[model samples]
Structures are given as structure tokens and as C-alpha cells.
Target: MKNFFKIIIIAAFGVMLYPLFDSFSGNGQLNDLASFYAQKENVEKVNSANLVTAVVVTYRGLDTLGEVTILFLTAAIIAFFLTKQSEVRTLRRNSEIFQTAARLLIPVIIMVGVYIFINGHLSPGGGFQGGAVIASAVILMLLAFPNMPFNSKLFGLIESTSGLVFVGIAFLGVLIGTGFLDNAILPLGTFGELLSAGTIPIIYSFVGLKVGAELSNIISGLQSVQADN
Candidate 1:
């Protein structure tokens, strides 16, 4: 009877999802809204080579700010709760090869993360992605050195400073440009160049740092809770 009910539920769920696929034309043409976003006229307005980034950091910039704020609150809450527990937690030993490999990869991973955010306006990746990549490195570090002290003060300062610069630049857009977070506040420079997207690269760099710091803090807090025994 349970098997019979499961089949019925699956059929019903598939039926609901099937209709959603029709919305995608799959003909490789941009929809009207997408066309507007990447339209040639916009190249002058925001010279970012990556249209998605133009939309994310310029058109819908406020949403990104809110997302960062939410992440900050979440990390703060988790850290608060975890601090009550003893910070001394023992981790099982990792193989020498494993430790060596992790140590070698951590710097490479961090560099890739930096590249992703810095090239955000010209390529597919952005601050959030780069930040997550950086956080992954911290995870590896925690596993490699279980007893490594978590630098709450340092990360807090980095996170706070990065967040402030992000907001400050946005407000600068309002004062100098037509709207908030407008990339046009500074010269949009030649399209496709590294320095082409006005303040976008700078903005994304700060965002990447802030996100990386917040995620690292969360991981440090979590590693404190688990014990080897």
C-alpha cells in the first residue's frame, strides 16, 4: 500500500513540474527582459562585459547588501551560541600525505577565489562565488590543523571593514551618480578591460572579503563543537 501511494505521489509531482519546462524556449535566444539587460545601449550605461554582473551589482545592488547583512547576522548568532561550549576540541589525526596536500592546496584555492571576484565584471563568477571558494579553503585548514586558534578579532575587523566600504561606495553612487550603486559614478572605462567596469571590481573585492570572513568565522565556530572522541 505504501509503495502504491508513493507511485501516485511521484506521478502527481511530475505532472506539476512538467508544465514549468514549457516556460523555457531552449532556442538559445534571450527573452525580452534579458535582451533589455544586455542591450547595446547599456554598454555605455554600465560597461561590464558580464551582463549578469551588471544586473547583480548595478541594477539589483541593494539585494546583495541585504544578503550580506543576513549572512552577518547568521554568523553572529551561531558564534554566540557556540562560544558557550569549550573551545578545546580534539580532532582525529590525518595522514601525513593528507596534511601535506591540504597545506599545499590552501593557498592555490585562495588565489583562485581572489581571481574570480576581481574578474567578476568581465567573467561569469562574482563576489559571492569567490567568497564561498575562500571559505572552502578555511574548511580544509580547520581539518589540517584542528588546534589552530580561531582569530575572531581579525576576521571580525576584516568583515566589518569590507562591509563598510561596500556600503560607502554604494552611497557614493547616490551622491555622484544618478542612483544608488550606479557603476557610472566613476568612468565605465573601455569595455572588456580589467579596469573597465568603474567601481564594480572594487565593490566585488570588498564583498568577497566580507563574505569570506563571515563564512570562516562560522566554520571556526562549528569546528569548536565537534570532538575527536
Candidate 2:
């Protein structure tokens, strides 16, 4: 069955890639709407060097919020179904190398994830990417220390607080700025710098924290259920 699925996926991928065989023709230029976004006026409004950050956090921030909500719902549903274990279970230990690696690398991995989100307004990454990276660090830790004490409530609190702060910032934009999720609720800091893009970095930071904690909650919930089984 797995082989059949793989074959089907390979064939579908091949069909999708067939279009690439055709000659790529057309002048390299931004489309009308994209060109409008690149205009000095619009760029200055968001004041983010990363165009994707401008679009996601400011222009279509409501959509970003919705996406984050969906993830929260998903984690909630998973936690609801996965009953927590009342007693700790002894699990097999990992190899020495994995244990050492987890100890040494978890902090560095987490720092990298934080960096990705913190500088999201100036670079190619954002909250989601950073959050996923953080989740991966948690995954590695879980694998290394299977019997480690997991703190689901703390993670939940962080997730909830971050989400609330994110919403509060959005409402501030509505009350003070021209529209919902406007980046201008605060001063648009100097461009091409760490503190630029007004509330963008703040929003993205909270988003990363929420997403990371939510994902960790789901993972720990799954682990608990597995222990029960």
C-alpha cells in the first residue's frame, strides 16, 4: 500500500512538472498589483524591507490571524481527544550521542528559530517558519529524554497570552490607526533596521511564541496519550 501511494505521488509529481518543459517566455516584470505594492508610497506605509512581511502582517493581517486561529483549533482538538496520563511511564533510553546532541543543540536551535522570527520584518522568514523550527527543537528534546517532565499548563498559558497580545495589537491598529492591523499604530521606525516596521516585529514575535507553545502542547498531549496506551 505504501508503494502504491509512492507510485501515485511520483506520477502526479511528474505530471505537474511536465509544464516546466515548455520554454519560459515573458519579460521579467512585476504584475500590476505587485507593482502597486512596490510603489514608494505603499512601501513606506509598511516600512518593511521584506515585502512578504509587509503583506502578511499589515496588508492581510486578518488572514494571518485566521490562519493562527486554525492552528489553535487544531491543537485544541488534538488535546481534547488525547487523554493525559496520570502516572509517569518509563521508556527506553536514547543513544548517548543523541542525548549529548540534544543537550548541546537544543539551545542553539531555539536561538536560531527566535532569530528567524525576530528579524522576520527584515529578512525572508516569519513567525510560522520560526515556530516550526522551535517545535523541531522540542521534538528533539522529547526524543532524547522520553521520560522528561512535560509542562502542558505552562505552554498553554504562554500560547493563550501570546494570542491575546496579538489580538490586542490588531485592535489597537483599528482604534488608533486608519484600519485594522495597520502597522502605523506605532511610529514606523527607520527602514532597513532591526526596530523598523512599527508593530510588525512585535506581532510576529508573539505569533511565534503562540505557535511554538501550541505545537508543543499538541506534541506533549500526544506523548501523554501514547504513554497511557
Candidate 3:
């Protein structure tokens, strides 16, 4: 009976979504606006080779800011719940081999994460992916050394500071450019270079740091809850 109901629900959703399926059909040609944006001259305006990054960090920056806000709120809620637990509990110990591997690998993982976000404007990887990688490294530390002191305070500081920096740059954009979150606030240097793309690298760097710190805090909070259990 449960399986019957599940199938019915799935079929209903499929039927409802069927009309939108035609939206995916492409005629193998760019529309007028799409063609304009796809031109090399237009792309060079943002000073980024990666069009997706250009869209996310420049064209739709406010949307990205909203996403970061959601993550920060979620981490705060998780931390609040974890702290409300009545008892302090320690996690079990792992093998020395695992601990040593984690200690050695954590820095390397963090460096990779930093590199990904720093070069986001020039490359494929960006703030969110890099931040997830950093969070994974924190998860590794928690699993390898369960009793290791995770600094929630430090994470909070980093998160807040980065968020502030991001917002400050956005405001600067308003003051200098066409409107809020404008990428033209800073010089769009030589295209395809590491220092190019105006405020893109700077914005993405803050976003990466803020996201990584928030995710690390959430992981630590969950680990604490698991320890208590």
C-alpha cells in the first residue's frame, strides 16, 4: 500500500513537470541576447574566461550573497542546538595511523581549497566547491582525532570577518559603479590573468573563507552532538 502511494506521488510529480521538459530542447543556435553575451568582447568586459563564474560572482552577485546568508544561518542554528545539550561527552579515539595521516593531509587539503577559490575567476573551481573541500578536511580531522579541540570561536570570527569584507566590497561597488555588487568597482586588469577580473577574486575569496568557516562550525556542532549520544 505504501509503495502504491509512492508510485502515485511520483507519477503525479512527473505529469506536473512534463510541460517544463520542453524547455530543455535547444535549436542549436544562440538567441540574440545569448549571442551578445557569448561574444569574446562581451566576455572580456568581465575579465573572466569562465562564463559561469562571471555570471555567478558578477552578473548575479546578490543571489550569491543570499546563498551565503542561508549557509551562515544554518550553521548558527546547528551550533545553537549543539550547545544546548546538557552533558559534555568525548568521542572515541582512532588509530595512530589514521591520526597521523589526517594531520599530514589536512594542510595539503586546505592549500588546495585556497588555490581553487583564489583562482576562481580564471579557472573552473570557485568559492562553493573550494569551501566544501575545506569543510571535508575539517570532517577528516573530527573523525581522525575525535577529542581534538575544535575552535568554534575562531570559526565564527573568520566567518564574520569574511562576510563583512564581502559586504564592504559590495557597498564600494554601489558607490563607484552602476549599482550594487558591480564587478567594475575595481580595475578589470589584463584578461585571463590571476590579478584580473576586477573584484571577482576578492569577492570569491571572502565567500570561500566565509563558507568554509560556517561549514566547519556546523560539522563541529554535529560531531559534538554525536559525541554526546
Candidate 4:
């Protein structure tokens, strides 16, 4: 029967994914690269409290650039998918308590998200982590106030402008620093200060803003579609 074949197919696919489950083993090419970046020479020059962040934002900045590009491309693809459909009903709720709670929490969440992005050079959190946190805050607002419409155009503009600004900063680094994406142009500042790492924090802040906006937009769109359905 068709049901039997479907079950078999799903079981096969699940078996295929089983190999992906593995315990952590740290020895690898990436570990070697990390060790190199953590060396005293690079760490002192970058003046970052978190060596991994320094490597990602400075030494391997081009890779970071590519990663950002991929995210932008993904957002574009998602937008394209949404554009094909019309008549989506935006999600809304009718709970006063939820609305009040969201309003109270939004500011606090935004502050924490900004702090995470700003302190990335000295901590475990970074632009992506902070961005997700902010996006969740936006989602909270959506859940609380279903009737309140979001300005999708404004969010899109902010996301696009922030991305372009990040590109411009990297281009400027080429002219002032060693090369394209080189971050030696700005003063590194103190090792553990918020303003340290030259322009890393600034760049991460932009990334966080862009990512948060885009992700919030995606959630908005998806919820709209779900409501329509």
C-alpha cells in the first residue's frame, strides 16, 4: 500500500540522519586555525578579550563578509517566496495582559540585546545571538498585540541600509588598513573595554540591527500567512 511505502521512505531518511549524531571531538583543521589566531601576537594586536571573536571579525573578516552575504541572500529568497502569495492575514491576539507584558518587556529585551552585541569582543555572545534575542522581543510584541500592524517597509529599509553600511565600512578598511576588510584602521583601545577592538563592535552592532529587523520581518510574514490559512 502507499502508506507502507511512505513509512519505509521516512524510516530510511531517519536512518540516513543517524550518522550525524556524534560526540564532540575537538581536533580538526578549524581547531588549528583557532590556535593560530589565539597566539599572543594576533591577540595583542587585535586587543580583544575574546580571541575567537577577534579571529572571526578581523583575521578572517572576508569569511565573515561572505557569511553575512549568505544571510542576505537567504532573506531575499524567503521574501521572493512570500511575494508569490497575496491575501495573507496578519496574526493578532486579543489579550490585554499579554499586550501589557510585551510593552513592559520590549525595552528591557532591546537593551540586553544591544549589550550582547556591543560586548561581543569580550564575551561569548555576538551579532547573531543578539539579533535573535531582539527578534524574539519583536515576536513577543506580535503575540501580545495582534491588531497592531507592523511597518514592513520601514523594517526592510533599515535592514538594507545597515547591510550597505557594513559593506562600506569594510571597503573603507581596505583604504585605511592593510587591505580590504582589514580592521587595523581604528584604534584598538583597551583590551577589556566596551569601545575596544577598533570597529568590531560597531560592525557587530550594524549586523545585529540588520539581522533583528530581517528576522522580525520573516516572522511577521509567516504569521500573516498562517493567519490567512
- TM-score for every candidate vs. truth? 0.90, 0.87, 0.91, 0.82
> Model 4, poorest ten-residue lDDT window?
84-93
* Rank list by TM-score: 3, 1, 2, 4
The digit string of per-residue lDDT tens for model 1 on 159-181 reads 99999999999999889888889
Ranking by lDDT: 2, 1, 3, 4
Residue 203's lDDT within candidate 2 is: 99
C-alpha-based local distance difference test score of model 3? 0.88
Q: How many pairs collide in each candidate, listed in order?
A: 0, 0, 0, 1
Candidate 3, 1-229: lDDT as tens digits: 9999999999999999998896778668988877776788879788887888988988788899999999988997888777735576755678899989999999999999999999998889999989999999999988887767888999999999999999999998889897888888788999889999899999999899999999999988887776453
Clashing pairs in 1: none
Q: Looking at model 3, which ten-residue stretch has the lowest summed lDDT?
A: 84-93
- The positional error of residue 133 in candidate 3, measured at the CA in angstroms, is 0.5
Question: lDDT of all the models against the reference?
Answer: 0.90, 0.91, 0.88, 0.82
Candidate 4 lDDT, 32-85, residue by residue in tens: 667778778878778889877887788777888788778778777777776534
Best by TM-score: 3
Q: How does residue 62 of candidate 4 score in lDDT?
A: 82
- 2 against 3, candidate with superior TM-score: 3
For residue 135, give model 3's deviation from the true position in Å. Answer: 0.7
